[model samples]
Target chain A: MNGLKNDGISEIIDGKRVIVKKPELLAPAGTLEKLKIAVRYGADAVYIGGQEYGLRSNAGNFTFEEMKEGVAFAKEYGAKVYVTTNIFAHNENIDGLEDYLRGVGEAGVTGIIVADPLIIETCRRVAPNVEVHLSTQQSLSNWRAVKYWKDEGLDRVVLARETTGEEMRLMKEKVDIEIETFIHGAMCIAYSGRCVLSNHMTARDSNRGGCCQSCRWDYNLVEMEDGAEVAITQEGDSPFAMSPKDLRLLQSIPGLIELGIDSLKIEGRMKSIHYVATVVGVYRKVIDAYCADPENFTIQDEWLEELEKCANRPAAPAFFAGTPGADEQLFGVHGKKASHDFTGLVVDYDKATQMVTLQQRNFFRPGDTVEFFGPNLDTFNQIIGTVVDEDGNELDAARHPLQIVRFKVERPVSKDDMMRKGL
Target chain B: MNKPELLVTPGSVNEIKKQIEAGADAFLIGEQRYGLRLAGEFNRQQVKEAVALAHEHGKKIYVAVNAIFHNEIANELDDYVAFVKGAGADAIVFGDPAVVMAVRETAPGFPLHWSPETIATNYYTANYWGKRGAVRAVLARELSMDAVIETKEQADVQIEVQVHGMTCMFQSKRPLLGHYFEYMGKSMEIQKRQGTQNMLLHDAERSNKYPIYEDANGTHIMSPNDMCIIDELQDLVEAGIDSFKIDGVLQTEEYRIETTKLYRKAIDLCVDQPDQYEEEKEGMLEAAEALQQEHRPLDSGFFFKETVY
Candidate 1:
């Protein structure tokens, strides 16, 4: 599951970047494989959730065994792993928390990201070795709150997405603790952890693991008039949409790095491996490129294009610049799908024979040209001329999920190198 | 335990006296721009007047400077907090930590309540703020009875719980209502839409309509049911909860007074005469039930476990 060691700042890969600074590029790891992919793709650290106690109870989170393995895998790359126990603990959900905290800590996670003080104190008491990074659910917008947590022994604080550039600057100016900011991924329209739309509408407590994402659903705006309901917004032409576009701060990489932002976070734990790889790879490049030459850096079109291929919905810069206007919102109900399909990931490569051992993620024909991208090399497109099964039998298509095949692509490959349907 | 003070959020300066007369021990008042989810926000003159009136009546008033501060709002934050403290507010209930610093910088010795809306679930978190000089903690509305009692038992800080009002389900910084209006060919003053007696939102899948409005803080969507736990006041009182809040925003003056009076009577009876309160629990529940609007459903919110999930 591992390949080349991650000794960053070693050399410029294809003249793109030689890592210079240590601003963390934090990615979401929904599974152990995703954690491997995230690190292999150049994420400095990854955040994951356990089966319970995380906000995404259904996120197929890591078991303690899996958590240990993921932590070990990340350690191989010299990256840290953070487990989320970031739920507001109700009385019923509060019983086994200390034991759960001890389990994750023993699993070798570098830190625990939590919002509530009870968990923070509990973890610090039960497992003093594990660091505490306050979750964004705390909505700490200014330096004073960061100071409060810092004084209370917090190792770091993830600023609320509503925090503006000025707020971040002031926070950096005032607080000595590490500050993490959300630079990309889906934006919650409401203040994080302050919403209970699911609890009210569906009786599922959002504070505990059951978020129905009711914010994305459509609604009808109405007004009461003398016992008769009057429709304010109509159907067909409209939906009472409150969905904020996914956040994309690709252009602000330099500003964030220059502003002394300690960590840049991408939000989505339940996303695909392809997404984790592409996004982590892009940010890794952008952050590296900017750090390599602070004054002469500019975002490349190819990086933007790579990001577009993995975007699950239309995106905006979000509150990075300021509170976005009407354009920031997704007025209609439908979410935009990714433009390209993730076809395969490189499991192993035989440089002597110029063949790649691939695991299929989507259906791909033998004749299809797929574009391959990796953190260690420049992206190149190769036409898939022939596919053979593990037993060396010819196959028409690489169809089944996780299907193993060998294809002669005549290209250099890394273990976690990913490919998508060509443009 | 002084039978726990009755804290009510008044919608106007005029309602503070009425609330005190109706048996409220304290009222939460603040400027709307600096407060989130307040029923009535007062200007400088009104805030000063309300504080004096509450002091005159030998009751306390907590000023809410709890808005999630943007840079622009934060410019006046220190002054606003100092103004509230200068006005002799009993304490300032704040959601932003900036307000805590403001209190420290400009209003030293002023007791503060950390009301980061939600996320103050367990006792350690409450005490965490208490260690930082916070005198009280506003418990999140999602806590269960067992958790609430545990928090009260463990924390040295004053614990405040909401016993009555409509719970706010969602809030956003974007002017979503104005955007919807402009999405259509219409325009309206979004902030003025609050308390219009008409505006509501109907989820496409759900049949009940929710109260929806906009303010400087942003759009707010409320629960379909108005949460009334008058019958459960005894449980909290016996658990030694320091304060019980009755949310008076979006509620009428009549409804606010009636609900406040009932909660007052219930807390007193729950403390002084538990048996008589037990005998009168049904009639009190009915009175609170009668005060609710016909369109708004009334239930004990998150008080019972079976439905909390």
Candidate 2:
């Protein structure tokens, strides 16, 4: 059992009977509903933030009041909540820093996530007891940077996304500190989070949490002859180009665990509940399976199939396995299409009657092929054969959006089962 | 009349000696194509050696340490500062405040000059650093002569203006192309091909066409207009600026000697006949035109605030 004793559960490791505390299955939640879904699906921790200061402003982030409710709700489920206030503050904006810090602290949040040194200093001075997780935005690529933050009283350093397992191991060996790495997510074209390109191009600093992703814009090539201008559009596109692949590191879980990385992070803060539930569930299963038998553990193909159903660019191992090249680059074309269109999920599945009822989001018709994604199950896809409406009459399709509907599922489904169409 | 400072960007040691023999006041050692290049093998110690050589010939030398430093190199700041200070160089030109503070703490007595990238738009920020410990502030290339005078009043330190060479239209805070190479898993050697081979897109086009290999993001041309303030020496001196800076970090010894001699002669005329300075303007323009012919279509730049965009 490789699990920590404080948490529940036991598993065998290294041919010895050891208690394996379930590793915290942290998930990204972009909305209130997604937060609830993540909690219900067994997320040990959820990281989120208010719209203004957090790194991903484009995501459906919570407001201050909503964040307060999020914290309270997570506490009820016995899970931790971390709020981001990680924008780089200039001298002028430092005035509001105290209020923001006080607000989050008073709200009973777990910790404050920050990147800038001045903000770190301010947080330490004002809310000394509040835990501070150093954001990856500071680009902690080297051990010296980590040591500096650790000396400054930082609780944990979210290592730069570009760091490899070997690098993480070396860092862990060098310092006695809590290290976190992004196990899954969108990889930045810039070094981890040191990008000022968007800010320079459009006054939307990624460091300040307002990133107008100018890197994603298209550009046309221009040729010159003898200093005389020659417009060349051989590629028939803007000379500006961008890579649009999402990072996936599912196979490297054992490697990460061996590296002694404290936490694994998932990148999307603007994805649906089904996407969150399916991904988290798949990872949770893989982690459990690995702990059961590290040497013989294998990632099931069905989990990879479920992952492919989610909306993503092409999946690549990123800089972890080795440095990526042009072959990995996603040019003008968008990658894979999402197989299932997300409707509301099954909040509760009745076991005895083989009936799975869903809190309908978008309208689902009888002929539409739907897939049920739940924890510990390979996402089962089936065409909607018989739909029982509110009137108990079998209908070809259920048209009303967000309406509750019942359908028969072949497998035994549990509570918090996510349902989607098109799979 | 004081001999005008001869700013030369020598590619080799022989060129440095040649410029010294041609009555140059100072040797400004920088990479030829790029505005300033002191990375890897070419570092502060090498710059110190160049400075030492210039000092041997009774010439002052200014080292350009103006590149943006990533956080990874923060620890190296103190060592580099100590080396420059210990070498007894005239001044260390810097852009980042982290570098500035590191230098101030490491070598408290050394003179630190603000690189133009500091964006000293007004006296507030200028005086902020000047009060801290800077000896000189390089005014932004885009500033009008009038704005320079305005800033001159509030500045506690000596003001240096770019009297010649390329003018950057955008701030140096733009993301470096070198970073683009890192992201794509390519070598920064790609920069030498694109950067040196052609004038950057933003720069004025010359007849020398070369292939512009786009970085992961895109390609940008160099600054089009080379600044010429030779005819305005009297107005500049009257405006109370202490030093005139030339931007070429890459120029032939002949170019440096001729330009320096002409400017030195103009400055003498201005001192000899301050009231009749207009009489010498034609001769100065002729000399400036001769240099401009070698590098055509010189821009007066933001000195008089002509339409740029």
Q: Pick the candidate with the highest TM-score.
A: 1
lDDT of 1 by residue, A1-423 (tens): 011122332356576544454589999999998999999999999999997888887787999999999988999999999998888886566688889999998999999998877788889889999999999887777676778788778999998888876668777777788899998898789988888888777778787778888989888888877757888776566878888889998988777766677899999999999999999999988887777765467779988988889887888887877778877788765577787899998999998998999999999998898888887868898889889999999999988999999988767998888889944
Going through the candidates in order, their DockQ values are 0.60, 0.10
Give the fraction of reference interface contacts each candidate recovers.
0.65, 0.00
lDDT (C-alpha, whole model) for all candidates: 0.83, 0.62
lDDT score of model 1? 0.83
Model 1's CAPRI class is medium
Off by over 4 Å in 2: A1-14, A17-25, A192-194, A200-203, A223-225, A230-240, A348-356, A376-378, A386-396, A399-401, A410-415, B1-45, B53-309
**Per-residue lDDT of A163 in model 2:** 63
